[model samples]
Target: MDRVHLNPPPAADVAERADAHSVAPLLNCLLREAAAPHGGSRDADGRAPDDGRRVYRLRGSGRLLRVLGERRPAEPEMYVSDAWQRIGHAELVKLVADELRRHTGLSNHELPAEIIDSRNALAALLTARARATAPDDLYLRSEQSLLTGHPFHPAPKARGGGPVATWLPYAPEAHARFPLTLLGLREDTVVEEGDTSALDALGEAPPGYRLLPAHPWQLDLVGRELADAFADGRLVRLGTTGFDTWPTAAIRTLYAPERDLFVKFSLDVRITNDIRRLWRHDLLKLRRTDTATAAALAAIDGPAAWLGDRGYRTADFAFEELAVLVRDGLRGRVLPGATPLLAAGLVEGFEGSPLPGAQDPAAWWEAYLAQVVPPALAAFADHGVVLEAHLQNTLVAVGTDGMPVQALFRDAEGVKLLPDVSRAAGWERLVYCLVVNHLVEIAGALAAHHPTLNPWPAVRRELARHDLPEIPALLSSPTLPGKTNLLLRWTGADGADARYLPLPNPLAG
Candidate 1:
């Protein structure tokens, strides 16, 4: 393991935090997807008794498990031999694997390793962070603030089990900023669409080649596969970019602050639910989906903005492997005098976070709902465009007072158009992404900080203002569709083909 340590924090401190980080999401998965609360029906509101430890029953094994904390479970203990035994990170992994094997009647050799890798990644990040200088920019700081990565992912920080040194230098959590490896693709073999004019400014290309900026990590992963292209002069290395680009929360997407542009590249590494690659199939239809989302958002009232996937650049032979997608930067997208922060980052707080110090949590919650809810609802109701407005996909810009003033949505590849999928199916996906994944997590974070604030009514009020037909049932429904990442991975389900189970709808008061 490669670690940077100057005035290093105690090794025990790093290990402890890593253990807690690893356990929380895994426990979240077990609680949501594979287990039932001890005694009667699973608690919808997650109300535990005075000690702050909650008991659960692993349905497959009938094992009684208890853990401390609600949002991020820690100090896990399991009932054994008529006694409770505390389990460490290693034991917890083994326990989870055994339970999943029994529960799904399936063995997953890969996910366990990925989960371990995620922990290892965290340890490395913690070590680097102690010595690394955090960025001064509030927005960039927020983007890189997700040290724990996806709150619900079993192995959110797994970097394809690659060498830690190889990926750590590019990790957002480490405040990494590096120059891109510039490649010049032969003009005749260059494949692209939409406005990629921003790419040319990154670096210069020779007479017959187009400027193609490749993520160095991606190149390292696939260089052997493209030996023919390089040897035959179809792809030429033209050195590196003169300036540095910071890796955002999405490790594959690098934001060049100097250019005020975002360039997403194909890293053959899995980040979160999918391999962080700009797939050709998605790229082929990028314009159509992005155009629809852009048009729908523009037509909606208020300050919602869509950061369209302007275009992609790739080689015909190594299209998917060498691809890069360009997206709109914050220059003109956000409202004037506002700082756009990653909405997901709000849940996973940083030093300058407004949520913790908010003077009026109720007012803040109302403003948050106002910025985030309308666009997704309007897009679905008016234009039949379902925006994947999950926490990671959305950006909330806050005014100087730290009140949210605007919402910006991105990732056209995740967008689904109407009639392409039935209205019912589209609505379910919208509800799951926008309400379940996005709002529920943020609300929990907000309420955790401000115990007196009940964030749901404001959410309900904001949502009810929308005229979507599904709003009535959605408000009254007892459960919302929650994507089962844990079971899906265990059962070898396709990543894109989501399978969901019922989660208590916080909106249904």
Candidate 2:
């Protein structure tokens, strides 16, 4: 398949010659320059940008260039002298194409006017480049150092599908749930084995902990001791069930014999479909939005207290794998717990209840926003954290009274904060997760139950009257959640006694 890559505006020699101007063209130029080279500097190889691409500032030019992968046109002295042009934007574009040509052995060329002007085309190119450059290798690292929800890390030796393992902390309530930060690991230093004694020579087991190997189908590698103990009767047992995300495996055993608890593992390749199932939900939700980019930008976290209040834990993370873990966990595990909240418990049919999808849209909206939303907003503020508050990622755990009791948030990997930066920025993703993904769901529910809220102009007027936070200003400010959801149920809904209310989206108005 044909793929595209964008280059930043080239050196003065190149930009002085073109006639067009726009951020898109500037980004294209920057990418090209970064792919080039730096003449003389200690950090000359040019570091990749936080978003995973090399951004190069030209030595003598005000323009910049960002290069990704090895697919540039191979003709040297490549300049857009005739058919194309550059744009002037707030972000300075750097140039390092000289370095890129040296690395990829590909020459540069000016894209046709049509390609250069189309935002969708440029975006598609960037996406293709990212995919082409993805490394197929992985390794082990501190889970704490990793982003809250990554699938794998770039390990030096743990590549090409060898024996895998994970030192996951045990959670009694959920299969994949673990402590906020700590995990159990083997005490020995051996990463590989050579002889029969290799099995027996495994690292010393930690006190009150065991090692379970990652059967080919498991998520993380487990400790050996824990696996064996689970086989025998030495470890106390917890319930075992097949995970939808990791269907190829079984929870061989989860034991809590006396001190501390441990989980055992085994795999069945058939389970890989779990990831597909979860991904389907993510894509479905993503497809429902027309303003995804804007929505994502609005959800970044800003404070520690806000994060803590909302039950979020912020820390340095491995960017690439975190989102995978969180997304999968949310759709396949956490949200299912809130099933009873819907009227008649009907997902696809039967619509006679008074909830969001029921007959009282206005009442539902007033009641929901009035009671349920505040707590979630405050919880995040108290902890100084930004959560992926998208609808599919959140759960409104309702009680028997048909009122919301607790807001169960899943996908820990998607949590982020303002004033904090990682390989991936927290702001945009935070917004997308919350407002884009979640707010839309809430709006839909309200529309179904409260039609008055759907009028765009009126809703905007009411929102203004409500004194909602200024989204544009807030986008740049470091902020936190201002309320919390303590899993409390609501009552006084005509005829309904008490039930769990849907947790208000933290990013919504």
Candidate 3:
């Protein structure tokens, strides 16, 4: 395996580039929802006025601002001391904090800290990525390639305030691979649901015990909390797995290539919005959600597949704290010979992304929509299973020519059931996840890479082919719901409680 440089650049260059990558997304969110652009002129290319630079006033504070870069804002400059001054990452954080405070009429100290932490994490990732080795498997490289994650989230890279050393080794961005910590739980104390038979193949437990595999990083974070369980004879350490597992974009889920399995653990730390723990409420409903989604996908008439969550196992005493989910790996679920790549990575860009090198941007965009959109819609209309089909939860499998051939969706925990919420509510969630969060990002990336291409007409055509009742309204609606991650975090709302603001709908002709 060839090792890529994961070392920091010259100190000055590292800080400057890292700041641009980190603050761009934060500025994007602020400008989109909370600030108003003014005195902007279009360039000769007509991409955006002033070479994608614009002046704006914060809606709440009415403070003047100037920034370069569109889609993802960069090189932010704030009007201070009667002139436009370039702001570093720290200053950018302060600007966001001030703007958000005035916008919401609420003050939050923690969010600013997280914004700073996220930027710091980006710096570390940039340095480490320069020195890290990309996996030989293109699929794995795509899965691990997200350096600037959730391009719209203010603090997407914050790792619950942990030191860089503690989280860097486990970060997918850092190209990390490590063995799982295996444990044996007394049979009487083992609580499991669904078919967790695959776990038995990882390692054998002594008689009267069941094998449990844990993420080493999670173990370190919660070690002291679990000392009593270890001492009480309920849990016994059985050493780490012989084979190493690679972390995916979602840090807590590990892919074990040897066994062809995915094990999702409950990490008590907050990654983006909520603590990444498999909460007791969600764990209790996992089986039902997974079953519904699995059945829904089974009924879809295309190559789209659902990677079912087979089952979960946890200690009775520490249910949420110790729960581990077993998910179906790619071998059986993914199309044979088709390479599956993370959709998020495709949008974020990786070495093998079909998006950039696409021979026909129109055809490629259409194929992508063909694979990703139909199943998600079918699952909802036919089986009432609302898949969280956002970029991260979706995978686009490409053929030898690097054109999208199939779509595979995962993470049953994020699936929502029908009637549990009104049809109207479910449709809103679907539109936001499928269109706003997933497709729009991909379309933007495609257009940015290939300027002559207009990705939306194809998107409109694809949606028109579908007969869902929501299609008509979706096409004509002037605005689409854009989830307010910055505000959501600032207000300390439940992460699952998605609140969306209206965003101009590109599909509206």
The candidate scoring highest on lDDT is 1
- lDDT per residue for candidate 3 within 408-496, as digits (tens), equals 99999899999898889999999999999899999999998999998889999989998999999999999999998888899999989
On lDDT, the stronger of 1 and 2 is 1
Q: Which pairs of residues collide in model 1? A: none
Runs with alpha carbons beyond 4 Å of true place in candidate 3: 1-3, 6-8, 39-49
Tell me the deviation in Å of residue 367 in model 3.
0.9
Candidates 2 and 3 compared: the better one by lDDT is: 3
Residue 271 deviation, candidate 2, in Å? 13
Tell me the number of clashing residue pairs for each predicted model: 0, 122, 10
- Model 3: ten consecutive residues of lowest lDDT: 41-50
Residues 1-509 of candidate 1 have per-residue lDDT tens digits of 12345797898999999988888998999889889878542222344446667889898898888888878888888878766789998898899899999988889999999899999999999988888877889888888988897777798888889889999989999999999999999999999999999989888899999999999999999989999999999999999998999999988888999999999999898776788788888999999999999999999999999998999999999889989999998988899999999989999998788899899989998999888898889899989999999988999999999999999999998999999999999999999999988999899999999998888888888988877789999999999999999887777776788888998888887
Model 2 lDDT tens row, 1-509: 11222553334523322212223233333332232344322122443334333334443342343333222211112224321132232122112233334434543431222223222222322233223321111100111111111111001011112222222222111122321212222323222211112112223334653322222223333234246433543332322222311110112222221212222232321111111111222322332221222233234232111111111111112111111111111222222333322211211112222254434455444444443344334434443445555542344443333444334443332345444443134444444444433444456544544556662333333333432344443333343221111100011122111122122232233
Q: In model 1, which range of ten residues has the least summed lDDT?
A: 40-49
Give the RMSD in angstroms, all C-alphas superposed, for model 3. Answer: 2.4
